[model samples]
Target: MKHWIHNKLAKVPAGIVIAALATAWALGAVLNEHGMARQDRHEVVRMTEKMKTVCVGRFLLDLPKEAQITFSTPRIDGFTVVIFPETLDEFQTRLAEREALIKAKPDRLGGDRNLEVAKEVRGDGGMTGKLLVHSRAVKEGTASNGLEIERYRHEGVAVEALMHGNGVSVNLASDFYFPDMVGNVLKLAVKLVPNPENKVPAEPGFCMDGAYLRDPLTADQLEQITMFARLPSNPDIRFLLILAAGLQPDKDGLIERDAATKSQFSPTERMRFSRLRAAPRTIGGIYGEEVVKRVHELNDSIVYSFWWEVAGTTDNIFVPHIVFQMDTGEGDHGPVPSSLSEGAAMGMWDRISSSIRVRPTQPPERVAAESPPTPLGSYAWAGERCPESGWWQCSDGGNGIGVLGGQRQYIRKGERMPQALLLPPQTLWEKLRGVQPSFESKTQTSWKLVDKRSRKRVPSPLPLAQATPVAAAGITSAGTGPSVMEQQGVAVGSFAATGLPCPASGWWLCDDPRALDGTRWFARGSLLPPATFALPPGGFSRSANSAKSIERRGAWRLVRLADAPEQAASDDNGKLA
Candidate 1:
């Protein structure tokens, strides 16, 4: 009985221990849940109150991999360009200095702790956001003892600094490229407007073409956008400048021929025009030339290629060409634009550099076979022989081979047979017919306008005369005189009736039959509405209006129609009746 009592006591102790452990586990879980809830709440509050400001910084420095650089100049108002260092140690020092500077000038920096953290954080997207740096490097070759010892090449690099609002957003991004020269920095001031809640990414005051432009201004209305170009940056990148301009036709058709010819337009307008013209052609030409020169200097095999587009009012057409010129006898090839086949250009590049290999991603697997065998025999393979059923063959014979016994067979019984073949299926002989692969045939030619003074070539604008009208009826015509109706505007319409001859130099005016109650009128003027007028078997011209009579000149005769009162007096005096 004593032993049994001892056993029961042992069981009781074990049960008590298990209960205590369960209670402790439950308490620990509750504490963990509470801590997580608090963290989530904090994050939500921080993001909700965050104010976003886009800062763009241009730095003339070599960027080291994974380097964290910061800028803390008081002069920087809206945007900031933080220069990255080439070495790890330099980056560290710069980062430390930036922190000290920020702490020193907290008021100028503003009250956003999240933004501050972003500015201070390191690593990709850690604090400030992602870093987009552009660089261009040029090296020169050297010649010794009457021989070329070394030639130095010039390179430019551009970098974009992006800062986030909540320290968690994808930082601003920019298109980066290498410049042709060194130590050149372009700075711009931009204003940004944030949403009412201020939690969203700061948007620029104006809608520009690309995201690289700076954004989101403060109440003081200050913002700065900066860009840097240096060597070691990607060469394929490009910058797009969005410009707005008032285009007015030259009334006199005379370009100013004076010393201050450039001042014909306002400074703003001139700058805008220059940027628009330069953005595509100038930048590309300058950079491409620099790249070629640099490659030559290094004695490395280099090739140059270029492709461009001629954008019409209706459609964008591509003109592609490849020029292979090499520095070290390594021949240059193409500067193909994106409009051309990227595969073809890459193939050319591969030929120049055998070490280069292009592995194209597998084409998407066809989800469904192309338009299942057309029921009407219009399908691409409809005329081919059906391997499964030897009986079903095109009228041209087996697989449209058009050979052997000339027995024409189409559909047999109720079974559908192949129809006529539109084109012969590609064969090995067809592919091998051209040894050169017709590369030059792919070349395209387009017309471009060249500025006389600048000697710059730009895609030409379509002429008004060559422009096809939208409506077939033709544009409306304005009156001969400068009436309000003429001034208001006239639509160009059909020219079926007006037998008026085409003008020699300036424009001619004519009224449509619809407007003149089936009567055609012709007049001479610089501007008039468009219409058709009926002429005599020959052509005619009208004289200016006079006080007495209306005179009409035609190939047939010169006739004058006088008032009716004069004719009435002649008849009354004939017989005194």
Candidate 2:
């Protein structure tokens, strides 16, 4: 077989071999391009999917009250719910229903049907206590195949219950086809007793003064009071308990009196006396023996201390001044609170507490100084000035001097001024020279002549003769060679002989001359120069090169060859390189 392959390879032409290599290279290039294109398409799809998920989450969160009240927000944060039955019979019934539903559509739900019935129990049955019940349906592999398949299509439902001293606090969080199931249950409860006060039994627990204390107390207070109550009893115990409860000594000094009484007795005897003092006491004095200390302690525990320097006061009440603070993890800190509620005191407290957190001290004020003025004429460039000849001029179409009136005027390049005040030949010559002459002079000459036919006195042809010669020379010079001025026709002796005078405004003539019927004339007033020279050299060439260099330098390039490889991998894996 090897000998046969060698024979066939030898018979292949060199051109054919080269063509085959080229074709393989082309195929590889096409495949690479296709792979890159495919990767980009996948990236777009993935980003679209992520955006859809985010949009769904936002839509759920931003729903109006009516919508949110009906359907709970999507569970971006992990949360589970368990339903507890009040009695064993109720538990058995609910269990049986769950089992039947699972059996009816095993593919639509999940649970362990054969598990012990008592093991699924939650709460203390009829006893008042909190308990957590696990949903056999939501367990791994327990959901019906059909329900599990729809996990991505919809959220599911779960239930939970906590038995408080007064009643039960039921939580129904669902992850099912409809999120409104839990909401519906809550709505039913709300309809039964729309008002919480009405729904919650007023006398569920003993409402004794101290009993109410335990009911509204915070976790810290509850722990502290429970520990204090469990302490060894003594005659001074009542005083201590009262103090712990925030009650101050009465005007009769009953608390101190009780303390003194306990000091003289033995520990056992003091314990007995303390129990006797536990009963409420009254004193016949200016101030009655009240539980002022107990109220103070309660207030101290509930009211967070803060420095509230405010602008005003009313009704002898300190309107709380609030300051808010947020942690962004970037070390940036500032006060966020701006306003306080008015009308309802309770509303004001809620707003202030929720919006502001007390800080140890105020932040220092930021002081910024004014920036210095920019340097004068910093943007000025070269070739921006007018030339000599007392004519106003500007590269841009802006104000320039009026040659005749000595006033500032505006003119554009390539536009001719009126012939009423035509520029003199000498003045035109000087302007073309681009510099003031060493010797400046003005001359005017007149001559008399006889008409060929009438033989009458008339202006001589001398002015015309001299002007004609100069005009011819100018035309020749303009066409053939370099010269200070180019002329196209005879210069009249009127003002051409005497150079045009410079106005007070200092206008300068442009180098270019206007031509009319072969008569070349200089502009009498200053001109607005061309914004850009038609033919520029030197510096312009350098500017073009600089621009090209900047473009070349600005082009993006991969810093490392390995970066390309990494990028390719990342693209394939849908990750940032």
* lDDT (CA) per prediction: 0.27, 0.24
lDDT (10s digit) by residue, model 1, range 1-577: 8899999999999999999999999999999887766665554343224322222221111222222222232112222333221333444454456445544542322442211211111211122322323322244565577765656664433333333322122222222333321111112211122122222123223221122223222223222332221112223322111111112222221122211454786665444221101112212122111111121112332323322211111110011011112111222243322221222223323232221111112344576975333221111123233322122222222243332212222222224333333233346776677321111100011111110111111222221111122132253334333343234343223232222332111122223222212111223221222332233332434533312222222221101111110111101112110
Q: TM-scores, in order shown? A: 0.19, 0.15
- Give me the displacement of residue 163 in model 2, in angstroms: 7.6
Clash count per candidate: 58, 39
1-577 in candidate 2: lDDT tens per residue? 9899988887787669899999999999999887866665554343223210001100101111111111122121122222222354554455466545534542333535322111111121122221122333333433367545433233343333222222223332333323222222221111111111211223211011111111222212111111011111111111011011212213334444545765997766444321211223222111112111111111122111111112111221111111111111111132222121111212222222232121112333456574332221111111222111122211111122122321112222223322122122246667898743332111010001100111112232222111123243233222321121223222222222113221111112122232011111222221112211122344346565432111000111111111011111111112222
Cα error, residue 217 of model 2, in Å, equals 19
What is the lDDT, from 0 to 100, of the residue 120 in candidate 2? 18
Q: lDDT of candidate 2?
A: 0.24
State the displacement of the C-alpha of residue 14, model 1, in Å, after optimal TM-score superposition. 4.8
